[model samples]
Target: MRISQSYIILREVRFHAFHGVMPQERKVGADFTVSLRVGVDLSLPAESDDVADTLNYATLYEVVKQQMEIPSQLLEHVAGRIGKAVMDTFPQVTGVDVTLTKLNPPMGADCAGASVELHLINDKTKV
Candidate 1:
């Protein structure tokens, strides 16, 4: 018998935060979008129909919100922190992928945004 893993995803969670290397960028802040994919075992939840058997997306949002509140110089750092925090908070989660995007970046080009994606797997499941 084999057990299949499932995911709880939070897509395009937006926030206005101060995170940048430039002084003005920090002072004025910028728009940020975060997308998270949390992997977990869904066997129990599928049968029991109970929220307890799966990770709560609301709680995950709080974790991301808390991390975003803390300013960082780079999007990579923010994405890494989100992935680590989600894995630490949910014991059942086997892995996490976080995408953090900064809208209207200060680069002198016609672009929508810049982003960083981080993928982290639990140590026990690492191969």
Candidate 2:
């Protein structure tokens, strides 16, 4: 038999950034939005009501924020770094979804915005 699990979502956490391939972008950084979906075993935290038993969202935010501060040429790289960082720091994280959106991209296109999404699973051994 299979069972369903509930996940805690930290959605649409916004960050101002200077990340891009263009020089002007680095000089005049724009706003970047990051949404993180972290999957973990919550039963222990829920039953015990212990902060230590669950994922520390505050710490997670700090880790992401610090990573975003570093300038990068590609959003893909940033997203991958964020995913790896989370998995490295948190032992309970089984899966992670990272979406990085750059508002008003420099593509000079007629589109409203541009973004990239990356899904990372730590079970590299199986794949």
Candidate 3:
């Protein structure tokens, strides 16, 4: 089997948190969505049929949830933190892409929300 590229995704993980520049935003908080695309080499896991050979998705979620609990002034900051956390905790992770969205933003726009995306490539991924 040839696994040219492999990644795991967690889509639309929802949370309510205080993350904004405005004071009211920090006070009232807002609904948010977090999506993650995690890159890794799936060759070992594919053949071994073992969770130990692959990333632990539950651990990944805990990492994300921990970051989300921390209040930040910008989505950029939050997203970057999440990406870095994943890379730091998982040596098997090759890359991480994080997307954070604030639902029904306080800003005076009719749009659904505002978002920020961050990407990080692991320098310590195992060969």
Candidate 4:
């Protein structure tokens, strides 16, 4: 039997935040959705069935929540911050993908949302 890399995902974690270049957007705020994909080795946890052997997703959510609360003008910045924070906090994570969506942005044209996605690999580890 071969054990390979596995992912722990948190999807559509929504928040209302003031994150935009426009003053009105900052004042009124808007809905934002965040999704994270965290990659790690699952062999230990698969065998031991121990929570301690795997990455704790609750902790990752808290990290994302903290970053979201700090207002920023660009979703790119927010997404980058999240990727770095997750990689820094969890050395076990070999790679991370972060998606941030801003619902009903203030553009003149009708649109459902705007989003930024970032993918990062831990340089410290060979993945």
Q: What's the TM-score of each model vs. the native?
A: 0.93, 0.89, 0.94, 0.94
| Residue 53 lDDT, candidate 2, scale 0-100 | 87
Model 2 clashing residue pairs (backbone)? none
**Model 4: pairs clashing at backbone N, Cα or C within 3 Å:** none
Give the C-alpha miss distance for residue 82 in model 3, angstroms. 0.3
Candidate 3 wrongly placed segments (more than 4 Å): none
**How does model 3 score by TM-score?**
0.94
Superposed model 4: Cα runs more than 4 Å off: none
lDDT against the true structure, per candidate, is 0.89, 0.84, 0.91, 0.91
Report, for all candidates in order, the number of backbone clashes. 0, 0, 0, 0
Clashes of 4: 0
Q: Compared with the true structure, what per-residue lDDT tens digits does model 2 show for residues 1-127?
A: 2325646577888988989999999999988899898877778877789998888899999889988999998999999999999888885688889999998898878765678898888784222
Q: Candidate 1 lDDT, tens digit per residue, 1-127?
A: 5566588999999999999999998999999999998888878878889998878889999999999999999898888888888888887788898989999999997788899988888886643
lDDT of 4 by residue, 22-88 (tens): 9988888899999999988888888889999888889989999999998999999999999999988
Tell me how far candidate 2 lies from the true structure as C-alpha RMSD in angstroms: 2.5
- Which TM-score value belongs to model 4? 0.94
lDDT of 3 by residue, 2-103 (tens): 999899889989999999999999998999999999998889989999999989889999999999999999999999999999988887788998999999
Candidate 4 residue 116 Cα shift, in angstroms, is 0.8
The best candidate by lDDT is: 3
